[model samples]
Target: MSNEDQYGGGVGSGYGEVGGTGQTRTRLPDAPSDPYGTPRRAPRASRGLVTVVGVVVLLIAAIAFANQSSDSPRTPADQTPPAATSTSATGTRPVDGKNGAIPKGFAHDEQGAQSAAANYAVALVSADILKPQMRRQIVRQVFVADKVSELEARLDQAYGKTFLDQAGLDANGNAAQGLTYISRTVPVGTKAAKNSESTTTVDVWCTGVFGTAGVGSTNPVSNDWFTMTLTLRWAENDWKVESFAQKDGPAPVHTDRTASTAEEIAKAATEFGGFTYAR
Candidate 1:
């Protein structure tokens, strides 16, 4: 299927001052000697003095608190920004096995979603997807149960006889004997959005090469740029496509570099290996 291009404190003190005069001191006679006399006890501290001491203690405590705050370790949110996760490879490893040739067992996290989306993009745009048996296998492997039958029917219609003829493939979706047909997508980057434990939507931005490569081939290999978005569900400990779509691009301007010969392009496409992408 050409499904390739969809869219202050104060203390107070009182002091008595005594002055000496030249006059002789006079003592008044006691009014009457009392049988019993009790001296008044000294007064407790004044309210102002107590208030000033309380303020000083509080100031000391506040200063100590400020110091401790400065020395405390920062929480995760306060550390240096997590090293640019987008476009940069992450530490999480890709799945170790395959379901036939398809990657199996992606991590059940955002990174897993991204990896699944990327690998699925490669498979979807690959030449194998054009063949009926492989296409059926791919649909069943990548898509969820609810979507498999519908997607299978739609894809079969899309890759029908007419499309095969235009692509120079035979009724069985095979390129003629001498020419090498190439349809491969390499993911440049991937993004995950609306990711939760059970569901995520991932976008894979890709650059692909398509068409047959040979001296007399009518369809010379050409480059296309597109983005594929896959909505995934976490099922049986792996991320599986619930649905997906393709759109034209966030493509860059064409470069002025010289193009390679058809033979070289075909050889490279066959020889080079693809990747198992992570977030």
Candidate 2:
């Protein structure tokens, strides 16, 4: 690794023929390195352009990431998200028990009000309403305490001996030998017109049979349609009627089906019991 060994090849590369004692060597200006021999790098301006484009791409990606991260947080323009569970689900206690044959306790909501209205409508027009004791029981059970006395008096006055006679019933409100009294109500649907925490107004659409059935019957049982509107108050963990009123004929056109025989009507009335709604 002598300096001469390292430098000799380089020095020899500059020499011409060395035979004559007076030989002269020419070192031409190292023929300017061929500009096209080795691979050329991109021009400075083009390299700068590539760098600028890469920087712009990075900024766009960074801005997109920021927007995606903020998506879950609501802005003023965003609507409120729905709750995972409903608030109405609470304070809901179904009428699992009954007060005698009728459901007594009800939920503290619109459904409860509708149910109470429907049941009350049925009781108000039932055959039992003709019996004073049963009528009293119904008034006490269905109406608010403040309204019970007034409603009972009105009902008693309405179902007097004269009305009973016209209805094909005796003084005791009973149909005579070989006849069956039919006064049954069926609620088709109920709607809550207004509802609040303590009070609700509801409409009960009902269909009923309200005449005597059986052979030699003076009053053949027939269908009647009516709507009963009841304003109810939430009381003693149940719904009770504060006021009630009834109107006739939002009835449908009469069905084309032939009327049933008196015997069949009487049999069906006795065999099929009324239903209590669950809300």
Candidate 3:
């Protein structure tokens, strides 16, 4: 069969047929002429068509402009929102459980990933990481089961004698008799670089204090800024750390604020305990 016949657009369909000279096609009346042989006025049909075309073109341009805008206010004509409301529907789900001091059971979505990253950033840099037993606990609680052993071993090696000494802590991760070793991390904000059903990568921006705080201390506590990027896997109905890396931050400019005394710093750190952060 012919291609046209097979596809059902056979001959005599008039798809490509052209009118011949003998066809009685209707024509618009010629424009009117003046007695003085002046140029005739364009046809009423032609003028009416130009006006219609202009209005249609204007309408199309207006619609295109409205659609191209990034910051337009939503209206009835706006595109429909996502079907799943996710975090918004939950309205900051309260974190009511903890594995020791670390918050657990995040929401399993973007908000949950961000909260996990922020909380884990605190655990990663807190004074507890300097202590062997506490470090192991933190690793097990905040990290994936497969990574717990590896992270514990790595942390043990990293927080050896020299490392502790630099931070004014002893082999047991304790400060000298008169000084207090203060290490604390405050998460400023969190952003999820990637979030899916099974995995999430989050960046937590933080400021922290590290070093000994006391009269005549060699390394008095000082503030530093950093960003921790954590990759989390959704395992056992919770977001657990698979891996984490940190880098010096997008820090704000420092003010020439008067420095507090080491004694005052130690007193404040002790008096004002940390918080359990939420989204």
Candidate 3 clashing pairs, residues 3+ apart or interchain: none
- lDDT (tens digit, per residue) of candidate 3 on 1-279: 000100110000000110000000000001111000000011112223343223222222221211121222212222545345422333685377999999998987888888887787666556665567776787678877886665455445434564444444577778789888665667787766677999987766666565457776645455655455566889988988765444344668877888788789889879998887765
Model 3: how far residue 143 lies from native, Å: 0.7
Q: Alpha carbon lDDT of residue 17, candidate 1? A: 5
Clashes, model 3 = 0
Worst 10 residues of 3 by lDDT: 19-28
Q: Estimate each model's TM-score.
A: 0.69, 0.65, 0.67
Which of 1 and 3 is the better model by TM-score? 1
Taking the tens digit of each residue's C-alpha lDDT, what string does model 1 give over 1-279? Answer: 032111000000000000000000000000111100000001113333343233222222221111111112212233344347466888888898999888989988888889887887666556676578887887688767776676556445544564455445776667788888666667888876558999886666766665567777655555655455556788777888765433445778877787788799989977998876666
The TM-score measured for candidate 3 stands at 0.67
Instruction: Give each prediction's root-mean-square deviation over alpha carbons.
Output: 38.5, 47.0, 31.5
Instruction: Give one digit per residue, the lDDT tens place, for model 2 in 1-279.
Output: 000000110000110000000000000000011100000001112223443223222222221111111112112222555355422233444477777666787878887777777776666556665566776786688767886665455445434564454445576757788998666667777766667999887766666664456776544555645454556788888998665433343678775787788899999999998887533
The reply for model 3, stretches above 4 Å from the true place, is: 1-91
lDDT of 1 at 92: 81
Clashing residue pairs in all predictions, respectively, total 0, 0, 0
Best by lDDT: 1
